[model samples]
Target: MKRSSDRTIKWLILLTPTVTIGLWEYTRHAFLLPYLSMELGNFLAPFIVLAVTLTLVLGLFRRLEQSQRALRRQQAATASLEERESLARELHDGIAQSLFLLAVKLDQLDRTAQDEAVKELSGQLRETVREVHDDVRQAIANLQQPPSPASDAWVVPLRELLGDTAGVLEAKAEFRWTIPESRLTGKEKVELHACLREALINVRKHARASRVYVVGESEEGGGFRCSVEDDGVGFDGDPMKAKERFGLKMIRDRAAKIGWTFSAERRGELTVVELRKAGADA
Candidate 1:
């Protein structure tokens, strides 16, 4: 039914201009031709009116087309972002928290171990549990982070998100953010926050190192770059193949939604995730 309606609308759109042009041509040749009078400007009157009206109508149509295109783009971006947020929440609230509890139990078991063999096993188990705990904690933090507000009212506080993420991993996660003193628009802030969160989450889950660095810097060209880097068990193969994981898909979707460029790669033992805002050449 919807398709049929759309088809009808399309046919009407296609026919309206044709019909109008045919009527104008007919009127010019049949009605106005016999009454042509150059001295009184009567001969040019119908032509002049038709030209003006056509110009106005065409201009209006162009504006409407542009508006519709903009609306569609915005809607698509919004839907993609929402989907990413939902996936992030599910990972954080369900998988990550559960793993964190398991890690706590493993810590308790480690402290209660007395025998040498049991102690050695418990120590290994504790390390594994800690790793899992850190991963989950990072996921939760990323998932729970609030989207940036829509007004130019305030910027999403990057310091808070960074601090919380660092605490979760118990690692030396340092942040260096440099934005203009002026506040960011709500949409810009939200996109930046989402990109940063995904990058940090990737670092926590994939990088096994004790140190991570996150930086956000606005470029001179009115765009920004956010990067996350860590020395960990980086993948040996293609970055695209590595990112085939579910979490990476969410990150990609979020970046695409915001019209940002996302790239991930391993340098030596370090994994780096970078997101660049679209501006100019972006």
Candidate 2:
């Protein structure tokens, strides 16, 4: 009911000026024009008023459009954030808990297995389970929150995450970071670090490469570019097909969410992942 009333009011408001102007013009022509000439002032006055009134209406329309756009953007951002939170909760409550239970089962098997080989297999299973658990926990933790605001010293934390990943993979990883030693906003650092981690994880899982190299440098524009390269048995399938893998999907989503360009391709025997931050050329 209120909305109907508001709509009616808007229509009335819009038509009132037009009706008044028409009525005044008709009245002036029929009554006043016999005694008074339609001089320049008399001719221009109604048009000037109409112009001012139309200008105000147009301005109001523009403001309404802007407000609607802003509201849509805010709603989209809120929905995205809620989805991430739900994903994190599911991972923690479902996959993570399942892995823990599997670890416990392996522990029990270790005690009951009679053959030495069976015992060794159980130990390996336990270790694998633990590694999986850790990886899932890290992924959940990373996705649970938004990126911190941009800061001057972003690369430091990224370097740490990379170093940790290298240790976890037990692979030889080298960093060629060139970001300036300035404080980066929290948001910038988190995104940069996430990109680097995704690249390294891909290398560790699929590349089967012994050595990995991470290079970070200032892009020609304002932002930066980071590349991870590994000399491994490169995949032969289409890159899009490979994205069916959850890890690759997550990497792509994270890059896109942060307004970064992400590409992965196999160059001969080397699998390379590149990330580019956009709109930095201020």
Measured by lDDT, the strongest candidate is: 2
Each candidate structure's count of clashing pairs: 0, 15
Alpha-carbon runs more than 4 Å astray in model 1: 1-157, 181-183, 242-244
Cα RMSD for candidates in order: 15.3, 14.4
The alpha-carbon deviation from the true structure for residue 282 of candidate 1, after best TM-score superposition, in angstroms, is 7.2
Quantify all predictions' global Cα lDDT against the true fold: 0.66, 0.72
Give the range where candidate 2 is weakest over 10 consecutive residues by summed lDDT: 147-156
TM-score, per-candidate, Cα-based: 0.41, 0.42
Question: Considering only N, C-alpha and C atoms within 3 Å, which residue pairs clash in candidate 1?
Answer: none
Question: Residues 59-175, candidate 2, lDDT per residue (tens digit)?
Answer: 655555655655665676678678978999999999999999999899889999899999998999899999999999998997787633221245556556656667766667777
TM-score of the candidate numbered 1? 0.41
Q: Give lDDT: candidate 1, residue 44.
A: 57
